[model samples]
Target: MSIVGTEAYPQDICSGGGEMKNLWASQRNNKGAASPLLHSRGGCKGKTQDCSLALSPPLGSVSLKCLPLLEARIVAWIGGPPASGKSTLALRAAQYGFLSADCEPPSSGPDWLSGFGAVGMTNRVLALANASSWLLGATTSGMVVGSCYGEWMPSSPAHIMRVLLLPEQGVYQQRHQQRGSTGWSTDGWRHAYRQYRNSLLVWQRDNGTSIIRIQDRPNETSCPDKTLFDACEGIMAHLDKTPHELCFYCRRTRPPQSAFWLRCPPECLGREGGERGGAGHASHEGASFPGASSPRADSDHSSKVATPAEMEEIKQLLLATQGGRLDRSATHNWRNPSVPGRYGYHSIQIGNVNLVGQRNPNERLNILRSFLNFTGKVVVDLGCNVGGMLHHLAEVKHAYGFEFDPRCVKAATRIAEIFHLPEHFYQANLNTFDPNSTFRGLEHAPDIVFVFNIGSWVGQWQQLYQAIANTGVPMIVLETNNDKEGAPQLRTFRDMGRKVQFISQAKDDVTGNFRRKTYLVTPA
Candidate 1:
C-alpha cells in the first residue's frame, strides 16, 4: 500500500526502516520538505524546511512484514490562569523524563525564536519531533498552541494533549496574591481566567479535543507538587505509556550505577558536597531564633540564664508595665527555663528570663503542628493575649497578633521587641475585625489563622469568621470554649455554612476544667 500527500499511513508501512531512511535521505539531499516519519526521528535537525516526503510505491508493492518501531510523539500543552502552577507542572514533567519548555519568553537568554512566537513555530515543531513527550506551559488562553500554532502540530490531533488546571477562584486569587507581583490587576486576572475557561470549552466542542481538567476542591489548599504528579500520571495514561521508575534520591528515571546506591551516577552521594540530593534539599543547619530549636529562628542571643539581678529587673518591669496582673481570664504564666517550676506573664526567653505562660504554649503548638506546618508560613493569631502562643511559634515567617485589650497588645509588643522576634501585635475588637485592614502592610496573605477559644467571648463571632473567610486563608484553627459554652459556638459556626473539619478534642490542659474541641474551618 502507498501513502501520499501527508495522509495517515499504517504503522507497518511507516516503520519500514530502509524505505523511510531512503526517502528521508533523498528529501534532505534535494532540500525537499521533511516527512513526519523523519521528523519523529529528529531528522530535521534544526532546519525550518517544509515537510514533503512522498510514498510512491504501487499498491501491495510494500511488504506487510515491517516491524513497527516509531512511537507516537506527544506534545502536551498545559494551560491555566496565572499562578495556577502551569510552569511548575511543566518542570515537574521534565523531571519525569519529558522534554519541557515554557511558552513565556526567556528572561535572560538568547532571544531567538522566543516562546511559541509565530517565527518560532518551526523550531517548536522540530522540538516536538525530537522528544517522545514534550510538556509546554501554554499561554493563558492556550490559543497560541491550539489555534495560532495549530498548523505546526503533529498530523494526529490525538497526539496533542491539552491540560487545563481549573482551581477554585479563591485558591487562584490566593496564589496570585502570594506571588507578590504587580503584573495583573484583580479585573485583569479575572478576565484572563474567564478567557482560559471559554477557550477550553470551545476546543472541546469544536475541535473535538479531549481536554484534561485538574480542578481543586472548594476551599481546599492546592498542593502544587501533588497536582503536578497527578497531571504527569494522567498524561502517561492518556498516551498509553508507562511512567519511568524514578531514582529514590534524584527522582529521575536514570538507574543507579551501584547496587548500594539509591541515586544515579550524576546524582551520586558524594557529588553534592555532602548536601542532600534532588527536591528534598537540606534546610539550613543553624537555629533561627534565640532559645528556639527551629531553623527559622531570627534572634541573635541564645537562651542565657538570667542572673538574680536581671530576673528582679524583669519582674519589676512586668509589675510596672501592667501592674503585674494577668489581662485575660487565663493566666500568662511565663516561665524561666532555668527554673521550670516557676511561671510568668508570657512564654519567651529574654536574656535568660524564660517567661513561661500558665497555658503550656508548647502543648497547644504540638496540636497545631500536627495539623499545619509553621516553617516559613505566615500566621495570624486572633485574640492573642500577651503573645504566648505567637511567641512560641517563632519558626513562622511572620506572626501577627490581634487583642482587644490595649494593655495586652502593649505587653505583646514589648515582649517581641525585647526578644527580637519577627512578630507584630495590634489592638482590634474581634466584633469588627477585618483581615484586609489588619494585614494591610503585609507582602503575603496569612497561611494559617488561629481563633483559639475566643468564639464565646466575641459578641459578633459570625462577622469575624466572615471577614477571615473573605481573605481565603487555607487553614483556620478554631478552638471552642468548654463543652457547655462551646456547643452554641460550634453550632453557630456550622450555621455559617462553612466546611468545618473536626481536628481533635482535648481537655484545656491549662484551665483543667473544660474539654475544648478544635476544628479546621475552610470555605465550602
Candidate 2:
C-alpha cells in the first residue's frame, strides 16, 4: 500500500528554474511498513532533475506492528514562512529523538489552514502518520514538527510549545534566490513575510508561542544554526519539567508551596496583567511593591529629582560606564527622587527613570526569600550583572559583587553610590576567580554566596568550586544555565566534596527565554 500527495506550483512560476513539484509518499510491504519520504522535482538551467529526500525515519527502523506500544507525542511545533529554516530546525530536533514531519498546507487555497481548519488538518496529518508511535522507545523527548505557516492550534491535550522562526527580510529573500526557486513570485513571498510579521505578535499573545528572530550577521556568536540548537535544547529541557513546576506567565520553575502557589503567584500575575492589560492588572494594584516601601504608599523619593548638573553628569557617567548602551546591566531603573525620564530595559521605575527589563529582580528576590533568610547576612554575588539583585537585598548586612566586565563594575558602583546602598562592586572573571585570595582581607566570611547563570561560562569549574568550598561559606546559591547543566554541576560539587541540592528550576528574568535550574550548595 502506498499513500501519495503532490504539491504543484503554477505553470507561470517555477522553483530552481523549473516547475516545482513536491511529492510525499509512504510505502508499506508485507514484511513491514516504510517511513514516509518526500521528493522534489524541478529543472536547473535546461535539464529537469529529481531530488529524493527521506524526511522521516528509515523504512525498517520501526515496524507498523509495534505502533500500539509506542508513546510518541508532539512536544513542539516549529512554524515559519518558506525558506525560514523550518525544515532544518525540524531535522536538527530529530537528532535529539524528536520525530519530524512536514505538514504543509494546500497550495491552492489560503484559507485552508485558517482557524479550526488548520488545527483539524494538522491533527489528521499527524494521526495518519502515526506520529504518536513514530519513535516511542527510541527517545523519551518525543517530536517537533510543523508546517510552513506561523499559526497552529493543536487539539492535543498535551502541552505543545509553539516556536516561530522569523528571519530578516533580506535573508528570507536571499534564501529563496539562492535556492533558485521561481515558482513563487518575489511579490508573493514579500507579502507572506509581511503577513507573518504583522500577525505574529497577536498570534503569540493568543497562543503563548515563542518567537525566535533569525538575523544574517557575520558575527559567529549570533550564528543562526547555534541559536536554533540552543532553542531546541531549551525545548528539550522544558519537556522534563512538570506542569506545576513552571510559572504560567514566565515559564520559570515555581517556588515551593510554603512560599506561594506553584504556578504564577500574585506577583507574576500582577506583572503579566500590567503588561497585557489583562485582569491581572487588578492584582498589581493590591500587590506590595518591593524594597522598604510601606503598603500602597508612594516611594520616599517619588517627589525627588536630581539637580540639573547631577542629571547631566549621571547621563555622561551612564554613557561612559555602559558604552552608550543604557540597557546593559540596567536591570532595575534609577527611579525615585532623581532625574525624570524613562530609560533602561526593565519596566520598574526607580526615581525618575523607567528601566524596562524583561526579568524582575524583585521576583527573583521573592523566590530566594522562600529559600533562606537574608536579614543582616553578608552576601557575595558572582557575575552580578549591574548589581540588580544586590540592590534589592537591602536587608542584607552588606553585598559584595564580583563582575567580569569593568564597565558593569563601574555602572554598578555608581548606582550603589547613588542609592547609598551597602554594596561593593569589583571586577573579576569567574573563569579564573579565586575566593581564598579575594576574601582574605574580609573580617568575616560571607553568610551566603550567589552564583547565578555563570557556571557554564566558568571553564575551571573544579578549581572554582574547590576555592568556594574553602571559603567556609555557609550556603551557596547557584542558578545553572538549564536543567541539563544541573546534574553535571552537581557532580562537580560532589567531586569537590560539597553537598548541593536542587532548589527548583527558576526562570532567569534577565533573558526571559531560558529557564535555569537553581541549586543550594552547602559544605559537606
Candidate 3:
C-alpha cells in the first residue's frame, strides 16, 4: 500500500492539476476490513475513509480498536527538528484519549501505529496534499496530528487551524548526537526540513492562515493536540448539559458539563469518559494546559544579535558540551540517555526540549558555560531567574547566584536550600553592588560569572561589558534577534579585531535555527 497521501478525483471532474488521481487505491485490496467510524460527510471523493490504524503489540486487541474510537475532533501538528521528542509528545496525547499517530521508527513507537498509517511526512508535504484527506477530516472527527514540521503551508487551501510546537535546538541536537552514532546524513535531512518550515511560514503569511503560535515548553503532560481535544469535549459537555442555544461548532452559550449532556459515546450525545469531571479545564490547570501563558516565553532584548550562521554555530558548541542524559536519580532535567549532561552538571527537563535553553537548566548551563569556566574557581549566576541553571552549576563547586527580583531571590534561595547547596543569593540589583555593599556577603567573587545576556538591552550591555572588561575576566555573552537587523552596540566589540575574538559555535541542537557567539576578549 502507498504510504503518503494520494490525490483523489470527484466524479470525473475536468479540473486542472494533473487529473485528480487514485494513487493509493491499489492498496485497498491488501488492507483489512474498514473501520466503522461514522462521518458527517459520507466520503471525501469516494475515498474509503477506513481508519488504517496499527497498534503496537504491547497494546492488546481490545485497546487497539477502543483507542481509535476514543479520539476527539481537530488534529494538531506538532513539529520541530527530528528526535526532538515529537513522537513522545504525540504518544502522550494518545495516552490521554486522543487517537494519536506518530512517525518514530518501529523500535521507539507502538507496533500497531508503526507502519504506513504512521508514514512520516513533513508539515510542508502534508500541506501539499488536500487537508480533508487526513484521517480526522475523513471521518469528520477531530484528531490530533502530532508532528515536528509545524512550518508547512499546503498548496491545497485547507482550514488554517494549527498549533506550533517548539523545543530547544541545543537539547534536540545534543540528544541526537549523543545517541552513540546517528547516520551522518541525519543533519542533511534536518536542514531540508528547516527550509521546508521556513517556506511554510512564508505560505502562511501569503494565505493569511490563522496561526496559533504556542511558545510555552510542553511540560511533562502538556499534550497540545490532546488538550485541544479535551477543550472540545468540555465545550460539548457544557452545551449538552444546558438548554442554551449553543452552536454545534462552538458551545459558548452552553453551561459546560451540565447534567443533560453526559450521554456515553456511540450516540452523538454520549460522553466518551462518562463523567466529564477530570476532562475539563481544572484537570489540565497545572503546566499541561495549553495556552496557560501568553506565548512571549522567550524574552529577546539583546543589543548585538548573532547572525543565523553564528547562531547555528553557537548551538553546535552547546550541543557538543551536552554529554550524558539527565540523572533521573537526581532532581534534574534531560533524562534521555541519548542526550546526556556533563560531569559538573545535571540535566533537568524543566520544559520541552525546545524551550530547554530558555527554561531548562541544562540549556541554561550550556548558555552560561559560553562565558564561565569553573575549572579553577566556581562560577556565579548574576541573575538566576529560576534556579534551573544555578542548581546545575552548583554541582561543580562553590556556585553562587544573585537575583535582582526579590521573588526570584526567594525561590532561588529556597531551591538552593532544598538542593542542599549553600544559601547564597543577593536580592538586589547589580547597581546596588557598589564597593560599599559589603563584598563580605559575596561567596568568593567568582573567577567566572554568567549574565543573562539574552535580555540585556543596550545600556545593560555596556554595563556588563565594562564590568567584565574592568575585571579582566574572559566572558561569554548570549543574545537573540531576528535576522532582519544586527545589534549595533555589539558591533564595536567586533571592530576591535584581535582584542575580542569571536568563536563560531552551534546552538546545542542540530537544527540550524538557534546559534550564538562566544567572545574571547583579552584585557585591554
Candidate 4:
C-alpha cells in the first residue's frame, strides 16, 4: 500500500528515482499544499481517503510486486498445450525477473471471483496484464512484462510480444494421453487440440508477435530453454527504443550514401518547395475520366446500371485480394507493423496519419523534387502503401507501384487516374516478387527503383537485392532506421558491387528522432 500524507515517497513503492521525486515535488509545490501521497512538513488532519499524488494519470492503490514489475519493458504471451513444457518455462522466466501473478482468489473471496473456470482464469490474467500496461502507458519509461498461455491478448498498446509455442505433434499427443480430461474420449482430446492449434496458426500469422517454433532440438528432443532465450533476446533487443524502430525496421544509424545526398534545387528546399498538382505538369489540367470511379470515393454509383457489375467485380477482386476476408485479418497486423497506433502499412487512411511525411516532410519532398526533370524515366515503388509519394513523382516520371493489398491497389489506382498521371499500382508481395514476369511485356527495364519502408521484414532485403541484381537497375532510393539492424541490407547492396550513397534524413513521428535516413544505391 502507498503511504499517504507523507512528505517523502518510499523508494520501494515508486520508481524513477530523483526525477520522479522532483516531478512530484514540483506538482505539490504548484498546488500550494502537500499532495495526499506527499507528506507536508506541517501535518494536517485530513482524511485518508484522498487519492495518491494527484497525478494527471491517477495512480490507484498498487501492490509492491506490481510496482516493481513496471521496470520490465516487454510483455510476452507464450501459448501452448498442457504438458508442452511452457509452464516450467514460464515459471523459470518469472523467477528470472519476468512478473507473474496467479489469478487464484483468496478463501474469503466469493466463488465466482475465484477464477475457477477456464474462461475466468483467462479473464483474470488478461485483466492483470492490461492493468500493468495501464501503468506503462502512464509514464514514458518503465513497463510490466507478462506471459500467458493459449491465445490471450492485452488491449494496451504497450510493448507487446506474442510467442506461439508448438512442440512436436507426437510429444503433444503423448502428453495429452498421459493426462486425458476426466470425461474426455480419445477423439475429444484430439478435437480440442486441433481447435486450439487452428486458432494458434491463425493468430500467429495475423497477430503481431515474435514467433518461437520449438521443434526437434539438436538431440532431436523438444526444448523450451532455447526458445525462451531466443524470445527474450529478441524482445529485449527492442527495449527502451522508440516504437518506430522495430524487429522488421530500424532507424538508420549512419549517414546514407554520399553521392545521392545532393541538395535540392533552391526552389524545392524551402517552405513552398512542393505542392499537390503543381505547375510542372499543367498540360493535362481539368482532365476527367468518365468511366474512372472508386467505390470508396464515389459511394453513389447505383445511379448508373453498368457500374454495378463493375462494382461487383471490384468487390470480388477485393475479397480475393484480402484472402476472402470481409474485414482486416490478424496476420495483416503482423506483416508490416512496427508501431501501435499505426498497426499496419495500410493504416494511413484509418489511423489519421501521414505515414510518409509525418517526420520531416521536407526530407521526402527533397527526394521527390530531385526526380522532377526526368519525363521518360521509369520509377517503381516497392511496397507503396497508397502511392502518395509516387503520385507527386508521377507528374515527372512514369511511376508504377507494387503493393501487397488489393484495397491499397484500388485506392492508389483511383487517385492516380484522377490526376491524369501515367502511374500503375499492382498488388504483389515484394518478398517473392518475380523480376522477369513483373517486367514482362514492357519495352524497357526500370531505370530506378524506390524501396521505401519494406526493407527490414523477412526476405525483404534479400529479395529486393536479388531483383536489383537481376534487373541491373542503376539507382534505388530507400529509408532505414538508424539502428544496426538496417546495416546488413546496405552492406548487402555494397557487397553486390553496388555503390551505396547517403541521401537525406527525415524525422520519425513515432520516435521523434531524425533516424529515418534515406539512401541511394547505384550500380558500380
Candidates ranked by TM-score: 1, 2, 4, 3
What digit string (tens of lDDT, one per residue) describes model 2 on residues 1-524? 00011112123211221211233211222221222322211101121112222233222212221121112233455666665666655553443345665555434434322432234454342231223222221234445665546533221112345456655556666665554334467786777667567534424333332233333333222222343444543443343342211222122222342122332335333222112210000011112212221111111221223456655554554444332323435432112112233222222223343243334454455446546767557787877766767755545655677776565566666655554454566666576666876665444457898887666656666577767877788999988867676667778778878888766554423344456777888877
- lDDT scores in order: 0.46, 0.46, 0.35, 0.42
Query: What would the per-residue lDDT of candidate 1 be over residues 187-306, giving only the tens digit for each residue?
Result: 867765665565444333323223445666565433433454345344434333211111111221223332223323332223221121111111112112222222222222222234
Better of 1 and 2 by TM-score: 1
Q: How far is candidate 3 from the true structure (C-alpha RMSD, Å)?
A: 21.9
TM-score, model 3 to reference: 0.32
C-alpha lDDT of residue 3 in model 1? 8
Of the candidates shown, which would achieve the greatest lDDT relative to the real structure? 1
Model 4, span 47-79: residue lDDT tens = 221112222222122222222223333345555
Which segments of candidate 2 are over 4 A away from where they belong? 1-353, 508-511
**Model 3 clash tally, residue pairs:** 59
Q: State residue 509's C-alpha deviation in candidate 2, in Å.
A: 2.9
